[model samples]
Target: MINCDQTLSISNGKMKVAIEGCCHNQLEEIYKTLEHIENGENIKIDLLLICGDFETIRNTEDFNSMSVPAKYRTLGSFYKYYTGECKVPYPTLFVGGNHEVMSYLWELYYGGWVCENIYFLGYAGVVNFGGLRIGGLSGIYNDRHYDLGHHETLPYNTSTVRSAYHMRKYDAFKLAQIKQPLDIFLSHDWPRKITNFGKLDDLLHIKPYLRQDIESGKLGSAACEELLFKLKPRYWFAAHHHVKFPAIVYHDERTSSIYQSEEMNSKTIKNPDEINIDIDEDLENPDEINIDSTTSQPHISEDERRDQIPCTKFLALDKCLPGREFLQILDFPEANGQLEFSYDEEWLAITKATHEFLNLSFNAVSLPRESVIQSKIDPELRWIRENISQKAVGLVIPHNFQPTAPAYGEQQTFILQKPFKNPQTEAFTRLLNMSNKINPDGQSRPQE
Candidate 1:
């Protein structure tokens, strides 16, 4: 699920919320895990939320330069399989991380499409799912602040700088803009706390990088901290702080109202009316002792339990065949790669959509010869060509006969159907115009 919110009324009297962390690029694995969890809980989830970093790309060029086949094979497969086939219990919500934002940026620049169900909540977005109001701040933290802070490192900034700082800053800005009281907050990074900023020594069992930031008064998302100081949501599901050092700062109505104030000679950051900070605890796990939910804290269930509620499943039969195995073995003739089994049709659509959705048509040029089999061989392609008569190569096919050792006066040809590269919209025009064009009556493309 990219991001979803659905109301789930549980018999246990608790509003069950399911939030997932940054998936990066492993959509299939994440979905499989969710499927397992749902099966075990015996309860349908109310909402499924995802904090950002959905895609994995280090830079813009790497994202833009991806081959069409690779993009279709990886992300295309995931989208097609999960969105098209998987059975998810709740309404899923998606938030953008640095990766998602950068991906969209690439789309704007290079022209590719993102998935429809996988919503790209730019800096921040809010959704109503399963009776819970969920808000999210995606992307790197403090991107605006980082932009302001590190103006000198202009041209090329490393992930460390962007991931921890700039994106954090941007998230904070987004947090301030959210007006309603949210039942949940799915943020990529941790909120501000003493423990969040510690030293980097692995043996010290401390989050050293965050510690350095805190020492410099820069730990956590100021946006998040400021928002907590303002709204103080009931639950904050954070993922960027992967190392597991849970710190909870209690806040009262009074603390929630006071955004900032100046007192005495220097500055005094007063705690909320009744506040306590405990470190190195996993709030979700029962064994971590330092922090307890019972002591002037929010109510927690004895177990991470969710009630299974009846859900509505949307089906698109024309595009997909539910319960039936829709499998294909794709072979790339140009590359020295072997075909492997994979799943997900949403991924395929996303890859193809990206080509047209982002309007990459102007810059990209494909001839009939380059058409690959996957796009042409599938039932979808045949339907398009025959029904719509939309001329353009959706698939590639090799011409029969050995091309390397052609007999004298014999010409070999490859059947092609993509739109002509020039102004004229013609299918198989390039092949027909070839100097060694073979007779159509005697020649045929290799059968699948």
Candidate 2:
């Protein structure tokens, strides 16, 4: 049995780690990487966030399908890869990929399935990394309405249904409703307009195919889009499209040129900056879109239980070889928030704190890599304007963490200019005061 607590633990002062998509049987890469890390550098990795697509099969029901061979063909293969090849170390966290979220939903709805050791964040949920709160929404499916048995008609497809069913709606809603703020957000799918590289399109063709699967649901989830626009986290990590390299998407701060021609206006895809705050894009009129989905039901061959639950089977692996783990270390005392790799407990604590703070500002900070932070004050001020002050952006930064100029190197401190007195500024002050008040103990508080 895998040890959930020590194996995949999250708390203050823990390591902040990252991993790309490991869909299906792509366990060899992780093994080789771990081996390389172990030999090349003595880094202790804390958290291994496999951003979606951990299952072997692209699309299939693991819940009620009787064909073990078919079922194992995908998830089974993935299972073997992890158990046999890469003994994943540290606490591995997973967000449901387009492939796995559906089956995961069935597993969650059905009672018998169990994923050992791994923390399966059901579509959306929040994880506490000590003082930091990392929230995520893994529900990204194209079909707005797919079939799931039981005869109870739902309004949206599995992903949308689960987005609301899981805690995403609440997370987005509460982020706006509350006076406090959340720290980090982990989403499998990037907000529709958040990336620069179309690289992932070829690398991870699954994401776009998944989008194609959703019947023109306006590109992406409006709820998720709304949260990104409104809450504006510190750092967000995602991997749906398997691009050779990761691209960062930052908020644009430039004034769009006025179009003189009407034809161009219609042809140009509206800049995401113009309409990110709108959540209405996600909700399809029930009349226009059929929510009474039966897609999964046809694939299911088992009889429904008295409780109306689908039957599921749990697989057990003997002496599972979890992935080799490493630690994410942040040198707070270094220039421009220098990030290095280390496993020391004391260093781990400081690194975790810095990571938590970074995650809190993921959406608001528009530079690549935390080390690029030149002026902490400037970023904090910019965050206030973009997120807190509601200022009109003049020069937008793309790829939240990626700096526009990589050669500039890391900045030590920032200069924040006092803005003209406005109602929003007052509101920001009120918010800061409120944060100080509730956090008398200095513990991070979730946005109500």
Candidate 3:
């Protein structure tokens, strides 16, 4: 059986680590890359973070169960790790992406061991690693099913398979409840319009083709944007689009006002005996509040204030491909084990009260669709619906524009490549070669 008792601790010094764009069943290549860095530079990676598309197919059964087209289905390297044919060389943590073995990941919905030394972060989760509080939300955003719960089950049919990738409202609600600061936040897709914050010219220069999507404001996830605005984590890492992009998000008074408003509103409940919620106070009203410069000023040094103001640094890397800027190493000070793994009390109370008021059970699987729709009119549920419904503002797309269609259809032709030349296979070959080179003694060394 895989070992799940690995201790997590980080010393006072800066933690050196490796980050990958997407692990599309390329675990071996990722290990080899880290191994190369470790052997060549004499540096140890404390952890490895994969943004998503971590296809952990264990065998033919898992391969058949995956939601990919029949022709695309093939068992990758995960089979070895699952069966103990090979073991992960280092501690690895990942979130689910669009293309994943959902059946396997769904079994560990609350986050648990995928195999020895590898972890799936669940639908949404916060885990402490050597004092650093790493929070992540798995799955991308799809507005059509944003409010829907995870009602899909195994042996997924065509519709359910697609639904598996969409982010659920419950997970998003739980994440918003986190009051503590997060050291890092990981997601599969970039927060919508995050590009507006920094170095846009550089990004556009590199990936000029994205100008249409960026300009049209159809690029990323709006739900992620709301969470970023609310939580303001130190560093946000994502992958889906497969490009190396970076941005600095400024924590303005607006974000602070929204948070403070929620905190204040939640406290205004005088008679705890009743579950009466004020819809007006609960919904975010950005224009109603004025920033009071005097009392609102944080008690911190100027440098610290500056650091906390334009605080969040957003980094997105390209997909795992050789000679690409898909891998990155960064340093972070030890969190000193100060991280706490708990839900925000207020959020939990609100979620609980709302459910109780609606006479809805946790997961509410048995509730009728009509009852679920009618429950939204309740004061507390209404507050949740209104508050989380903030869509991307000012992003206008041409009505004639079809995202899936080629812009210049007459001039463009698409070709499907053979399986041998597939990028995943290439990555596997690279990993195999690296492993062989590293194991000159012909003995496999467990990555730590």
Candidate 4:
């Protein structure tokens, strides 16, 4: 529970409402739940933020791209919304999770409207709503393919479909460049070791099965952890683990590894006096640093260094399940002005670099003439082949290899069950009940 006094002071008198959780193809249920909160409880929600696993399957064709078991493939309620048979009841925004229609999401890699009022945050994006800055990183972390470029093409093959969920390094890099304050941040997976900030005993009591993973530190994402440390947003939300857990991260105590790496790189200039490094001229003083002669590094006192001490409240909700704790309504202050979307410049640069290296024609080997004409006409594609394809000299695919599923061991089996019930749902329900009792009338309560 967050204290109402503290939250209201920062909200600037604007009522920004949010419903945090995974939709899991339950758009109608989510809408009905919002209606219940508004009409029944007399609470009006302004913004709906679904963490992920939304399953925005627009039609039957999208079903083929979903990473689900063959028998479970079908267009869900998203078809109705996509066809304009129904409309989103409110302003809705979402990110991609491990389980989704990658084909449809990939088409909007830069972030775009899925329907009238529904927006997908693309691979990674930042947008302003009601004057509040919101940032998001879609997909989960996978170490194996984290550094790889997005080479997966249209009409995705079996392996590429699964590969689409792995978080890329470029997306994380783009997120790192946001130097402004973020009111809220969203991701499909939790930051690694975030459970340590909250009551682990309480969490374990509800979902005893997770003890092994929690103790072994085998849960959540390292990439997300780095971003949390760097950004330190006011509120962080996630859902893939399907458990409603709240953790407050104090940024002052945690130093970002990215900053440390940069410091190390800057200090690694061996024999600086011997090298003629080009130094950018400062407007006030052109000779800020002498390029002809090396200068000793300046030492600064502790007070001169930048300090990041803001606290971030991290909350993860369960997947949509009846009688479960899957939704929350929190008030945010109004935005400073009209809302607008901005693409990450670092991400755009990465996209161009990736296109330079991996954008080869599909028919390069089978149809030479057609490939040549297509390449010649498309300057971007030609640049990719001429500059990047030659560098992939010894690339080889493992024989009879299959990509690993996102869920591990027992969790994988659990997801395959006919009537699947995520293990974290029950514990989350208990936690929510406890919170409700403390606040009773749905008012904010102080966090312990």
Off by over 4 Å in 2: 1-16, 25-28, 56-72, 75-87, 101-114, 141-180, 196-219, 244-448
Q: Could you estimate the TM-score for every candidate? A: 0.43, 0.41, 0.63, 0.63
Q: Enumerate clash totals for all models, in the order shown.
A: 58, 58, 2, 3
Model 3 CA RMSD to the hidden true structure, in angstroms: 19.4
List the lowest-lDDT window of 10 residues for candidate 3: 1-10
Q: List the global CA lDDT of all models.
A: 0.34, 0.33, 0.58, 0.58
Clashes of 3: 2
lDDT of 4 by residue, 1-448 (tens): 2321132111223454565578788888777766765554455667788899989775454555778888867556876676567877887888989988775676556555666677787688776666566788999888777777765644567887787777886677657655667888999988988877665665777778888877787778888998998888888889887776766665665443311110000100012122212323221211233222445756442222222235677778787776455776666644444333333322333334332223122221221242443333345334434543435531111111111112111122212111112122222223212221111121121122
Model 1, 350: alpha-carbon shift in Å?
31
- Which is the better candidate, 2 or 4, if ranked by TM-score? 4
Report the lDDT tens digits of candidate 2 across residue range 68-97. Answer: 233445434344322223344544556655
lDDT for residue 122 in candidate 4, whole number 0-100: 69
Cα misplacement distance, residue 92 of candidate 4 (Å):
0.8
C-alpha RMSD between model 2 and the true structure: 23.9
Model 3 residue 118 distance off true place after TM-score fit, in angstroms: 0.5
Q: List the residue pairs that clash in candidate 3.
A: 89-447, 131-337
Model 1 per-residue lDDT tens digits across residues 1-448: 1111111112233344444555556555455544544454454434445665555332222333222233432442333322335433334455554444242222211111133234333344444433445565654455344333212111223542243223433224334534456555666655554232222243135445555675675655556656655655644555554332223333433322121111101111011221111212221222222226558865543221111211111100000122211111111112221121111122222222222212111122222221342343354434434533333532221111121111112222322221112111112223222221112222222332
